[model samples]
Target chain A: MTNLMRGTELARDIVLRASEKAAGYTERTGRKPCLATVIVGDDPASVTYVRMKQNRSHKAGLESRHVALPEETTTGELVAKIRELSDDPEVHGILLQHPVPRHIDERAAFEAIAPHKDVDGVTMHSFAGMSFGHSEFVSCTPGGIIRLLDAYDVEITGKHAVVIGRSPILGKPAAMLLLARDATVTICHSKTAGLPEIVRTADIVVAAVGKPKFVQGDWIKPGAVVVDAGYNEGNVGDVDFDAVTDALITPVPGGVGPTTIAVLLEQTVDAAWRELDA
Target chain B: MTNLMRGTELARDIVLRASEKAAGYTERTGRKPCLATVIVGDDPASVTYVRMKQNRSHKAGLESRHVALPEETTTGELVAKIRELSDDPEVHGILLQHPVPRHIDERAAFEAIAPHKDVDGVTMHSFAGMSFGHSEFVSCTPGGIIRLLDAYDVEITGKHAVVIGRSPILGKPAAMLLLARDATVTICHSKTAGLPEIVRTADIVVAAVGKPKFVQGDWIKPGAVVVDAGYNEGNVGDVDFDAVTDALITPVPGGVGPTTIAVLLEQTVDAAWRELDA
Candidate 1:
């Protein structure tokens, strides 16, 4: 029987832990943990993502502060706004909705978020910390994938994990995290040759290329665990759901999405605790 | 006819360019490019390494400032000394000799070096920059490996490059650089299973496990280029030199050593230029 990797169930457990911690933190400190969500322009997808995060924050007993900037905001203006949030003592975490205006320098804006409060783990400092295995804030998608794997008691050490995609926030960080767990990790992209043959050799496969059904079932090894991090149009995923007879796999709609929000809330609470101590 | 990748010749070209650049900088600024070499104790190998770096600096028309801390120096003291060098306007680059006293926090010491002046690329900032495909200073060994590959005109794009080992300064950084160049990179370590089978698939193989003759030549694909970055005891390398027929390979003593120092000198000069501009 192939086990469905139910991200919703796993995410519930994590959210429960974070919620309890946040309650106690609020009770003791007389203030709730705060996450500031910043968005530039009104990209429909970005707007929905921010709303989902804010809703989840409320469910987790955390405070959500929303900032909406105009479409004409320049990179300098966006960075200045992020810096203001970074300096705000009440804000414990910051999440900048990605794909800001085409003219805005997204990297510069992300870098403006202070490293300690980078709950989304989009900055260079966060990437460096993850690469060095120091356990600082990890990009939410990759962190969720790890939590899903650990919940299933999957043994990562000595396994061969092939990751398809190299986006800084998703694919690249996922490979590094797998490597840190002692898994032999191979990162492939659109430029990679012999893609199917490479996927067949993996003990674990992570499909994050953002192309719906890009990875066929036949490419996966029997009994291999697969995590599909791609959420494309119509709620489709990179891996063809019907193609592979896998020992474990995450479903497209519910698999990775909920877990991402769970990790964000958990890290937000963690940031709050760290800040309180400081 | 198999081609031997000669580091000395490539390094000579690089050093000559750096020397000319350094001479011009000195004439313009009335001061030479300076590299500060810091050692924690009198380990013979460490001492010899520092002296070699100093000798190379002079040969390249750069000045070397050596700081030998006592064996009993604490991590705090070491960090303080490095910070002093970081703040010194004359010191354009800083090199912290590795394997400090067992109790000393080497990571902390490396972090103490200012990011712009981290010529050796041992700090976390340099590693992230390499991973993100932004050209900052790279760790010397990986920088040298890239230079050697470039010198030989090895085609890396879309190639399968397997790197053995994951040491922070060498293996990890080397894999990141290869990935940045568009190669599908697999990182293997002691925990990796079926290592030989994995190696046989590589179009390019980098042996950096520090175990002498650990990677047999039979594991190498025919016509594949091999780079042995390991300089094991007794002038041996991780790859068994006599065991495989390959298109190109780097010898143990001269393959990667000279190019590493060359990159150090070159980066020191580059750092001086950046600092002067700032």
Candidate 2:
């Protein structure tokens, strides 16, 4: 019997707890935990992502304020807007939709989000915290992946984990998180030699290379746990799911995606609690 | 034919270039590149290390400032003194001797060093930069390891590199630098399983576990390049040197140490240039 590590159940449970906190916070402060999301351009996919996040936030008893900017927005303008939200006491957390027009300094824009309010965990400070094993928050997808593993009680310590990507927000932070958990981590990217052979050594595999079905069935060891963090255009993942056998795996659409939004809401509530305490 | 990768000659050549830059900067700006060294209590080894750095800085046409605090100094007091040096216009770089008394919060003291003056690269900002592959400065020893690799013309891209140990300033940043160079990097710590088996897989190995002669001869493969970052008591490295054969190795005493100090001085001068420009 193949075990599917479905994020749906886990995400629902996490969101339920977040909602309770949100309701309590609202009753006490007369305001719900708020996530201010900033987006540039009308990239159809990004638009859909933002809409889904906002809808989920509303359903979780949280308030999400959306800021939409034109395709021609400059880096300075975007940074100023994010900084304004960061300084606003009403805004508990901040999320900036990435891939901002290609011309804008995306890192500079990400850096503008205050560390405390960086619900999306895109800032360098958040990345450092994630790497160092101590921080107020973590990057959403990576954070969710760890929670997913813990919920399943998969062993991480002393296991060989292969992370196949080097993206600043995704692959890099995921590797760091695995390392922090006492797993021996090898980071493999496009430049890596003998890719399939390297994946064969992994007791745990995380496919985050952004390619649909990039990981072949033969690449993984039997009885290994696989976390497919890539969600491609065809509702497929980086792993060739149908060909994979004898392993626990997370499906693409209902796997990492829902848990990502769940973590965003959870962290937003956590941030509001800290802010209220202060 | 075993090739011994040495840091002594390369470090000397680097110091020569830095001395010229130091002279030019001093002639133009009327201020020598200055490194401020801070120490708490009088641990014999720590004192020797700090004094050596000061002597090297003076010989390289740089000014050296020393701050010695009592054993009873609190974290706040250490941070205050370091902050004073950080804010000083004359101090271009800051170095805090590590292993600060067990009672003190060392990370707090390290964080107090301003990013611009963090020549030793002990701050979170530098760690982020090292991970992200863009920053004006990097942790000194890790920076030196990369230079040593470059000088020897060792192939990094598409190679398997294993880093043993995960100290923030040494092993962790060394792994990041190797990853930045496009090497498939594995990080192994005390918690890792099957140690000798993992060491056999590396095309390049960095031993930074702070143990004397921990790695044995049979643990490494022939033609592998080993960079010993360990400088344990009695001047022994983590790798058992005499027992190894058919591999390029760096000697314990004359290997990583010189290059580490060279990178510190070079970055100090580079920081001075930026300060003078400003």
> lDDT of each structure?
0.93, 0.93
Q: Report the TM-score of chain B alone for all candidates.
A: 0.98, 0.99
Docking class of 1: high
User: What TM-scores do the predictions have?
Assistant: 0.99, 0.99
State the iRMSD of every prediction, in order shown: 0.6, 0.6
lDDT of 2 at B214: 96
DockQ, every prediction: 0.89, 0.90
Candidate 2 segments whose C-alpha is farther than 4 A from its true place: none
What is the DockQ of the complex in model 1? 0.89
| Model 2: residue B28 alpha-carbon error in angstroms | 0.6
Q: What is the lDDT of residue A62 in candidate 1?
A: 98
C-alpha lDDT of candidate 1 relative to the true structure: 0.93
Chain B TM-score (model 1 vs. true structure): 0.98
What is the per-residue lDDT of model 1 for residues A26-70, given as tens digits with 9 covering 90 to 100?
Answer: 999999999999999998999999999999999999999999999
TM-score of 2: 0.99
